[model samples]
Target chain A: MTEQLRESLSALMDDEATELELHRVLGELESDAALRQTWVRYQLARSAMGGQPVSHARLDISRSVSAAIAAEAGAETSRSSLRERWVRPLASLAVAASVTAVVVLGGQQLYQAGSLEGQSAPVAASGVSAVGFVNSLGAVPMRASYGAQAVPQLEPAARTAYRELARQRMYQYMQEHAEHAALNSPQGLIPFARVPQIEE
Target chain B: MKCVARQLASSVVCGLLFWAGGVAAQGPVCSEADAEALQWLARTVKSRSEVAYQGVVTLQRGDDMQVVQVARSLADGYSSEHLTRLTGQGAQVVRPHHPLNCTHPGEQLLTLGDRVEAGDCGLARYYRFEVGPGERIAGRQSVKLEIQPRDMYRYGFLLELDQDTALMLRASTLGRGGKILERFQFADLSYDEPLEPRSGMDTVHPAAHPHPDDPTAGARLSVPWIVSWLPNGFTATDAADPEGPRRTYTDGLAVFSVFLEQLPRELRPGEGLARLGSSLSYTRGMHLADQPVLVTVIGEVPVNTARMVADSIRVAR
Candidate 1:
């Protein structure tokens, strides 16, 4: 890990960083022992005044519960994949990783959905469109958000449609990335410019 | 009595010696087999990123299937790509650049190198590697390297890397049953040379309109909603919580939007789920933990994933 990362972890220990900084550190460091120990120590220090122990067990429970919910929600979203029951748990696991990742999400959603009330006034007054960009491996470049008007109400019918749409889109997006990664993989003989046509 | 005590003490010393030796052997060390696999995996991933290559890949979703022919050229932190469907659409092509998504020009994107480290023992922190039985894929022999999760928070991955180049030829998402939830299989592939710099630039040109001004851009948003919990590795990459309209939260892997438009008090929308093409959305109504609350989760993950997220939405007082 870079010194900057270690320093950030230290800042987290001291509660000197913003929520986003903490999230970034957690995202990359969650899998690292040295980093995780440092984080646990920070939590203890932060909660020391209250004499509360770091609740790793509680955190794990929350993660599992959240993942389960996400997977069930995904089940109702996709169509034409009835036989693919095996994907449910895996989907849940992916979603579980986002459990402790709230602050950034909470803030971003507030911003994206224009729920920040007074916050949007200045930006809107400045004539800024709240467009989102999802960065992927270079080449697809940038695909803009569907625009502000695209945010439809969560009506019963609309909600159903939205769920379906989300699953299909995600699968396609991930598949596309995997394809690109595989195509550029260092093996076999086909050149990058001449990948054979794939059929659906 | 003294002779008996001496014999007992000698036995205790022998036990201590054995215990120390066991502990020493247990200390962390990379086995030769693990070293070979990791070395090959690291070299393969690095080389793949910097090369021009092509392949035919089969993507399986549940029971549905799609085959794509792909071409990619990597040069100078950029990638040029073209994807054609042999069975469906004429050819849907994409020439993506390194750092794949750029909302604003000149914004530096994080690379794979920045996210994951290299080395035989390095990845052990994130994953536990286990070698499994060999399987033939895409007309070639392959070995399965199962990347099991060290924690329950993330999914485990089963990879079939080519025996020759160590290139990952096929991969699957594995869950509770050792079941394959989703998979991508390469029919054929090859990288001719190490990647070059100019490759990424060729396909990426800045958008004509970096920022667009529109009348509807400044839509009003309602709020007081909250999410009870979020996973560990996720962080909001950006926010649009301003007054112009709704709010959106996204992790690199998932995105959720919250629209807080005040509905007519008479509208008591029930929880509903739907699919539109590839996306999924869920809607639920309630009085915010304190105020009236209506929550909706829309994303490209499993339905359970969305529902859990939706349920977690409680209005902050």
Candidate 2:
């Protein structure tokens, strides 16, 4: 955005804009997409500063998220070329978070669909197989291959990832049981040994 | 013995005998050996809470092994343990061991003195406790306390308790036919049998911990999920006052937890099972009180035993 139009946005946010400045901001907002985006940011920042929520409107996060994904994709491509790519934990976490989020949301949807009148869980609408999602998330442990469901042409790495997720889920139940056991068992802290060393 | 050991926290031994044997309105008689084992169990229970120690423990299941570093501390009326997994996953956690200042379950019974008859420690009907010479573990001499189950419903235990403090140095869960199910023993320990007091010890000291009959402790509330069946001798722990989604019970020597949780979505699987070491967890998803709920029975019991417990859960009407 140009300096003149940017100043108009600032003036408009402060509500100190003259009729000319108001018109300029409004006129520029129509032709300049960047200026409109800036105006939203300005209003958000102003509203937040004043301790007032602008509106309960969902903020636009797609652009930033897409930018982050694009940047990560590049990093992933380059990292795969190297012998060691252990450093970028945050980058890997983003990918894992995205994967788990999809799994959780998809599982919820599939489960909810199956839950109606106690029907069987259909395949996830996201096209992931229902095999692991239905079986693994149930109260019991089952022989499941979540990665195979993720990619029918399974890579060994995918199998490992699925195993990791299953292990994480299993630990959750184990930890809950361990906490109770620790309280009443004759061996106080010893029961806690059963608890896995992983944080959810 | 664990129930008696737990009873040492507060409930009367004679009172327990009344329930165990149900012989008469008067407390039933417990054998002299039963009473001595109860005393040993009481000491063993307290030692784990009041005594502070740091050590590395090795746990072995049928084919799996885990090593953990544990530091136990008694401070601020609260004893706590900091455990770090030395083997896989590097999981670390700190949990409250037990409250020293808070009324321990058996502290009141200890004050009962002569009432704790070497004759009737009151747990004999369910378990036969034999205190025998223990082999040394982690450079400390121990006394072996074998709790043999009176029936096939529950498993037995062989515990190597620290001779002086009664801290359990090694413990093994005995399966059917005396099979070794799981064993957890200290690989090495930073030893000091006598507990040292730290600051926070200066609290409003109660002359005695709350007794089982303490009116203010309130009557036992019914847990939400009704367990229609439990292993032969299992009863809700006297000190268990949990007002949450889970409740634990003990046959004294063996403990199991009943967890009731609402599922956000129903799972397609019918009965789910998980096993680690001696612990078996059985999860069954069923609607209760017009809500989707998962009833899980997790215990150091046989898979079939846990499955029966899980099957027996009903929504308390």
Task: List, in order, the clash count of every candidate structure.
Answer: 102, 12
Candidate with the greatest DockQ versus the true structure: 2
Interface RMSD of 2: 19.1
lDDT of 1 by residue, B157-176 (tens): 67787676555678675654
As a whole number from 0 to 100, the lDDT of residue B93 in candidate 2 is: 62
Predicted candidate 2 versus true structure: per-residue lDDT over B1-317, tens digit per residue: 13334444444543564455454324534566666677777776666656778887899998999887777777666666666667776456655434563333223322222445533334566677787899999999999878887654567888898888787789999986788999999889875442222223212111112223222233343345577766554655443344246556665566677766665553222344566777766555455554555566667775555545654566565
Could you tell me the TM-score of candidate 1? 0.43
Docking class of 2: incorrect
Error of 1 at B177 (Å): 1.5
Top of the candidates by TM-score: 2
Model 2, A1-200: lDDT tens digits are 77567555554443434446655655565578777555443332122111211222233332333345566668777765343356466565664454323222322333334433344432211211322343332322212545224222222322232333334334555665555455545666466676554343
Residue-level lDDT tens digits of model 1 in A81-200 = 655466755554444334333322322233333332222200100110111111111111112343322222212223333234333333333332232222222322221112223223
Q: Given the true complex, what DockQ would model 2 score?
A: 0.06
Q: lDDT of all predictions, in order shown?
A: 0.41, 0.54
TM-score between predicted and true chain B, model 1: 0.55
